[model samples]
Target chain A: MDPLLYDILVALGLGLLGAVLFSAIGLISGTDETTTIAPVTLLVVLLGAPPAGVFTFWMCAAISKHMTHAVPTALLGIPGDTMALPLLQQASALRNLGAPHIALRKMLAGSVISAFIAVPLAVLFAVILAPFGTYITASAPWLFIAASVLIAYFSAGRWASVIALVPFTLLIVALQSFTGAHEVKLGVSYFLGIAIGPLVAELISAASPLERKRMNRSEPRETTLAPDVKGWGGYFPNPFRVLDRSQVRATATAAAITSGTFVFSPVAMTVIAGEIVGARIKHAYHRLTSVLAVRNGVTESTYIAEALIPLIAFGLPLSPVAAGPAAPLFNAPPRFTVNSETGVVNNLHTLMSVSEFLIWGLVSVVIATLIAYPFAMNHARSAAAFVAKRISHEAIIATFVGLILVIGLWEGGVIALLVILTVGLVGGLLYRVLGMNTGVQFMGYYAAVLSVPAILKLLG
Target chain B: MNNPTPAPASGPDGQLAEIWGDVVSRPQLGKAILIGAVVSLAVYAVALATIAPLASTPAIGKALAMLAGIIGCILGGAICARLFQPKRRVVEQIAPGAIWQTEVLDQIAIEGGAIGSVEDLPPAVAQEMREVGLYSVFQDYEQDRARNREAG
Candidate 1:
């Protein structure tokens, strides 16, 4: 068999495997599989990439996982990745409004558009921008500061969030001081991830108190394409469809740009991109338009950036999001680092490896979208009715909180409890007293630390 | 489970936001600025003392210390605010009644091709909920109306 053919068959099979695994676990646990796949896939690559033959296997496995992750998110409220959170919101809101099928259709359409648009664009952009990357990264501190401030100002609200700016700016400087200490000691951002992580886990755990009672809920069935909303026009850049076109443009632009800048910094970029895109959309368009664009833009951008970063910058396996399903293919190692500092030609160097990964990943999205959209319309009504009858929303959220707590504990040991307790106390207070978003406050804290020192430096 | 409820006067959300504001509030704007200036000086003192001895690479060490100084300043500010006013939840008033009217309900019924049984709702509410995609909330109203009719 031709190598390309071989890779496709293997990739397709793996995608099926990923879909089955995600579906089984998602249905059983009542959590969305899409939410878990990308991180897991990246983790697989991170662990398994150093071995010669494993890189191809990891790439195939990851693409397969991305292909199927959308199912639970579109069908249920479970987002496959953090990027899918906004779509989940719109989908759930629409589900409540009795048009879940339409929402799913729209999401599938947008995902497909972005998948096709983003992958090739990211690849080309990486190729075009690769030469300048080292220089760009060197100058990233200022960019990071600027991005943080912009995100803070907008997300916190111009006036209201400004109150958070001082403290938040200081907090970033504080966190960075700590991060710099770890960097000198540990040599990279990896361990710093360890420290900053608890903060997030604590915040989520604190804010998310488990609900004791399960509430009544309905589920929407897979939908068929409505006659009016069919064909390429339905899925493509149809500028006439004002709201939908804007969603495509914003998500595509954000996703593409974010992937290109992945190596500079992931968290800062994710938050900043989300804030900027969201705020821009909010300002440029109506509330509904902004909601659609920002939601789709952030979710898709995060996913694209994760996949692109390791592949382009270091020839490493994609992030954990893409790595999990890809694990079994590379001989299921207990641990492996998915990076290629040096390698023989045609034998999967980082450059070729990532390009191949992007090419195939794009192809899978197109195929998945075609299959999902038509299939969805037929099942929409039944799926909706079944979902309504079977699942409870409150129960789902409670389970999610439980999962977060478990994950937090797994990550931070006994500290998870303290973190959660602290976050809940602080988060609750912020919620009750701040007259602003807790997420903004959280971001502001991180940004504040970054800003204070930068300002002092400027003054001096 | 005995979930602690808020006092009747102020709700949970309001109380929490207030405490956060107080904690982050700049006290006697002039005094706070003066305090910030002093804190900046202390940071400089600490930086000069620590960097000269502790650093293997003087540049990286100084950079790291400066980062530490900024962190200190923020912690100092937040701490100062908290000290100024001990953490306390403040309460505000809540308004009552359906923030809606019955006329909009009849119009919505006409538009959706449903029976014009708008008696259960005020039009203002029906209109607002519909706009926000919360129309299903009216189900409770319909249920209540049904119960009243049965009782009558």
Candidate 2:
């Protein structure tokens, strides 16, 4: 067998695995992308999968998750994940109008179409920006600082998030030195801590006497699962057919435009794009459905561009998506590392050629579309019902607890476990209090690792 | 308006609280976390003791152990799922075309959305609305508003 053929085979296998796994995970509402994708991708990297396999896996996982996430958002009236929040209003309106299946179909179609458009377009944008890679890598320390502040300003907290970065970065710096003294250098533990911060904060607040009244619930949450009507005949519905001509144009155009604005938050991009598209349409029903399509489309395009552009152009985790969910692709350490001093990178960017990234990126998207799109189209109602009825929230929390313990312990032992707890507690509180989200916290981690050293040297 | 107002149910063991976007009994959550920790760590420890020495490299052995530990995490979750039922009251949404459906249009108008005349919609969109049975609803609403404006 040809070595290239072997690599392709491996990439396809991993891509299928990622697609199947994440599609199911996506149905279980509230599963955050970063918290789920980063650790699993890190595991793949550490387990010594080839670079192409890792890249394909991450791409497939993110793409598939976004598509199936619409299931819960449209049918169950719960935002599937953070990205699905912007789609909730339109979805609920459609459900109220007795057409949740239409909402689900529109969102799924938008995602599929956008993902196809985004892959090639994002690759093109990355290539156009690739000329600046050397310059970007050289000034990475300063660039990380600027990116952190910019990302913080754009977060929900705004100025509060910007101000919070100082303490947050310092907290990471302090923890590093503390663990360095014990001769246990930790990276994944910090990532896991920041990624799981919200859950940590919620758990602590649940235990607190002061927060008891707020946290306690006398009755279980009541959710109305809308009846799903399958309008299409086949298992695989054509995206172009599902969307009207104008809807297809809106989705494709939004996907294309957002494929370039990789620097901003994906959620913000989704909201802004929907607002722009929604304001154009006059009819209320058209406005609602069109916004759902465009917003969901923007979610796919923004995530793809944000992750791909930084990886291919600079081999750096520069964008919020890259820094958060796609961090492992750029810097999984030992297997993949971004050198702090010289800014040299040893990751998928350097391992795979530009052509390979484009090829595997498309392959992953195709795989995700083949699996997740049709599955969501055909089995959405049952899948959503299964997840809502059977999967206990306690079980999910337990799984995460196990993940936190295992990963923290695997990385460095007891000292690393303590680091995760400390970081998770502090970061979680800051997130709740200041609205400095996980994305900002991830950028703060990079600032601590990259920027702090350069600043110290300048002072000296 | 067939939706039932959820009645508060007493927990079998302890207090119920909403944590991390879902409701869970406090005692159940605690037990779940314990199961998660004990099962995963126990798997890791056993793998390190048994599998680590047999592998060619220490790192590979450790990586393999971590993989097993992840499997243990899922297993622990499966066990917890079997033991604890989800604390959610799910109601099948009643058929559409209720008064609430019209109110959604009113709500959209209040939110400054344009409930443009159905005449403005593209043929495809208008057809879609008709298929979904919303075309008449929008037309009726528009007529009622027009009458109100004329009377005023």
Best-matching candidate per DockQ = 2
Q: Candidate 1's residue-wise lDDT over A23-135, tens digit each?
A: 23332222222223423343333332323223433333333233333444544445544335445544444443333334544444444455556667666755665675555
- Candidate 2 Cα outliers beyond 4 Å, as residue runs: B1-10
Q: DockQ for each candidate?
A: 0.02, 0.65
Range of the 10 consecutive residues with the lowest summed lDDT in candidate 1 chain A: A211-220
Question: Worst 10-residue stretch by lDDT in candidate 1 chain B?
Answer: B17-26
User: lDDT by residue for model 2 over A187-300, one digit each (tens)?
Assistant: 889988999988988998888999988888887778889888877787899999889999999999999999999999999999999999999999998999899999999999
Cα deviation at A418, candidate 1, in Å, is: 2.7
lDDT of 2 by residue, B30-62 (tens): 999999889999998898889888888999999
| TM-score of structure candidate 1 | 0.43
Q: What residue runs in model 1 are displaced by over 4 Å at the alpha carbon?
A: A1-103, A156-354, A363-378, A381-387, A393-398, A420-460, B1-152
